[model samples]
Target: MRTLIFATAIRILTPLFLVFSLYILLRGHNHPGGGFIGGLMGSIAFVFHTLAHGTKQTAKSYFSLTFYKYDRKPHHNNLSHALRLLRKNIVRNKKEKPIFIWNYYLLRLRPTYLMAIGLAVAVGSGLVGLVMGKPFMAAYWLKVKIPLVGSVGTPLLFDTGVYLLVLGMVLKMVFTMSKD
Candidate 1:
């Protein structure tokens, strides 16, 4: 059911959707559209790509575009390589025992770890505020100037945690559904 025109249009539009999603994510703290909306927006681009290119192609493209360098080399005995192989198995479903084990690890364990990290980050941000003798989830800001991006805050970190959690959940769903 793939259309050339649809595929081409998706290829062109995906980056724009991703960029716009990031914009929404960053601006969410000060305005509307926080991590939840931004994550949905980002997932929309991948969903569109899946519709246009099929799940396997969409998953491959999404991983390659989003992650760096690991997909290029398959033989590297590293954690990233292992993760890449796991992702590959999600689409391809390799029949070998070792590969199946890896696939199980990736599908079952990795998402949990990601969710845990997201929770830790989100809670840690609030804990920082609590440690500072403020109410939980209180806003904290540092006026130090970093090049390109000036002035950072704890809200951004919390938003980032939300972003990661949403992203992991969305991707886990996508991968699981796509496997069928």
Candidate 2:
């Protein structure tokens, strides 16, 4: 099957993928690659690793509880860990895969439930605040005052929320699709 060969390729590609993903992630603030795309590449690399080895190996090498939630410490190590596990779910179903019900949608289990919930909270709060000022994506969001973080002058936190939400959702979808 392609899984075994893919596994070998995974070993070969993981390191390179990781290095490149990191480069992309770090440059995201200034360039086009940013956290979301960078996180996606990192997640794909880990998925390849998982396919080559197994979920247990994948979990040890990649997933952990620390990555699921948030970290208050300095630096962005948690983001790396979180992205790796975000989309990790059943890629190949041991049982029969379900057929799509319609073109409208299909159903699958997602692993980043908590992260999604948190994103909803942050985004909900952020939107309420944004509407109070100027409801626009590029209209100087940072200038809008937040009650806790500071005066209306920093939308970085909102961006962070979006990043987390997308990262978790994308990874979860990938993992689920693979499992199917």
Candidate 3:
């Protein structure tokens, strides 16, 4: 049962949750919060969205591609036709819906891919220490300091890997449950 207020609140809160999750993820290495918490926070956004809308609508809106076909005129040289076509396609796609290229590629990924990539990243971070003549899973850091984030290190990469892994895991669960 979808309610107007709930859907509106979800639309407002989803982006905020995602942004806060990133903040948590970024600050995790130096502070209390880390990848696991941040990933949970990030996953909450989609979960809420799924609750507000159905899983199918949420997936279609965020995890699918919007393709537009444009045909060039043989005689017309001006850009007006192309602009018109673009406008027409945009109108046809959906009213007030924003199409972000980043969302299309990133959110469309299957949970398995996310898990594999996250595992690879986590393992690669550990291997970096071995390559540097240190013990496996040893922490390594760059000399240069980055603003806000401070020193960059292997721990950060490992945290990022954890973040992706957790996000994938939770999303997989959510999608599976939604199917039933």
lDDT by residue (1-180, candidate 3, tens digit) is 589999999999999999999889889988655888999999999999988998887777766666554333474456885576578676775555542223223336666677788889889999999999999989999999989888989999998898889988888899889973
**All candidates: TM-score:** 0.64, 0.45, 0.74
Candidate 1, residues 66-166, lDDT tens digits: the string is 32232333557789877877787777745655443221112223444556777788889888889999999998988885554445688877877787677
Error of 2 at 46 (Å): 1.8
Superior by lDDT: candidate 1 or candidate 3 = 3
Best by lDDT, which number? 3
Displacement of the residue 96 alpha carbon in candidate 3, Å: 28
Candidate 2 vs candidate 3: the lDDT winner is 3
- lDDT, residue 85, candidate 3: 53
Off by over 4 Å in 3: 65-107
How many residue pairs clash in all the candidates, one count each? 0, 14, 0
Model 2 CA deviation exceeding 4 Å by range:
1-16, 31-33, 65-110, 114-159
Task: Output the better candidate (1/2) by TM-score.
Answer: 1
Return model 3's CA RMSD, one decimal: 6.8
List lDDT for all candidates, in order: 0.72, 0.56, 0.83
Clashes of 2: 14
Model 1 is weakest, by summed lDDT over 10 consecutive residues, at: 100-109
Residue lDDT tens for model 2, 1-180: 347678778888988987776566555544443556766776777677766776556655555533233333454357774464443333545574442222323233244863676487446656765676756443234556445334432244444444556556666765666652
Best by TM-score: 3
